[model samples]
Target: MWLLNGQSTWVNGYFYPGENIWAQCDLDCHDVDLVLYDRNGRWVAEDTLLDDLPIVQAPYEGSFAVQVIMAGCRHPRGCAVVVDSDYGF
Candidate 1:
């Protein structure tokens, strides 16, 4: 659960209007922040759970970006990210 300073991961995806989207980090990750951004590069939703897992919902439609950031870690590591939408599910 250690990550280097300023270490983060980002993924880009799209979402339709009124779509229900969720993003979560790996269970093993410690102190990770999940952020969501709209197509205009504006912040949409964020998850900052103390358990190091974040689940965010989309605020609007269009393209979106999901980012996983290490709040404060000392080691470099990776974590699994899950993004789901109600469109196909």
Candidate 2:
């Protein structure tokens, strides 16, 4: 998924406490961030590293969302990001 600078996408799912989510991009993308938000959009966990891979963990079990943000991309147009999780069947 290609996203422009400062662009964000939301992933909504049912996650148990301690679940994990990962956002990975190619070398073209230098900075990507993942943020975990509660059902009410409250902040939970986040990974904002200078590397292309970022991850976050679930703090509570219930309806929650993960926001993927593209902070910086070496690509001209946008950065391609793949979001994955260890939870779910």
Candidate 3:
């Protein structure tokens, strides 16, 4: 989980294969984008739009990368980001 304090981007470097990744944003975050990248820096999947919901499944057994971007928001309390995966880290 991350508390985005006016920052629009966050990155993670550890993800497992065959694991289903999901990211949920706080209500304050109106628009958020989530993207998954392979070990080689290739885009695996991306989720955009308010209701699209960023979700991706690992393609192979290796460490992957994840990126979350806060496109728009309207809360003085900032936004919360929760990331989860099916497999144990």
Among these predictions, the greatest TM-score belongs to 2
Cα lDDT listed for each candidate: 0.64, 0.84, 0.68
**Candidate 3 CA-lDDT value:** 0.68
Query: Candidate 3 residues 30-67, lDDT tens each?
Result: 66667888777889887775652577777777777777
Estimate the Cα RMSD of every predicted model relative to the unseen true structure. Answer: 3.9, 1.5, 2.8
Over 4 Å off, model 3: 1-7, 13-17
What C-alpha lDDT, on a 0 to 100 scale, does residue 6 get in candidate 1?
56
Total colliding residue pairs, candidate 2: 0
Rank by lDDT, highest first: 2, 3, 1
Q: Which model is ahead, 2 or 3, in terms of lDDT?
A: 2
lDDT of 2 by residue, 23-83 (tens): 8987788899998888888898889877788978877778888889999887788888988
Where does the lowest 10-residue lDDT sum fall in candidate 3?
1-10
| Model 3 alpha-carbon miss at residue 68, Å | 0.9
Which one wins by lDDT: 1 or 2? 2
Judge candidate 2 at residue 48 and give its lDDT.
Answer: 85
Q: Model 1 segments beyond 4 Å from truth? A: 1-6, 17-28, 72-89
TM-score of 1: 0.63
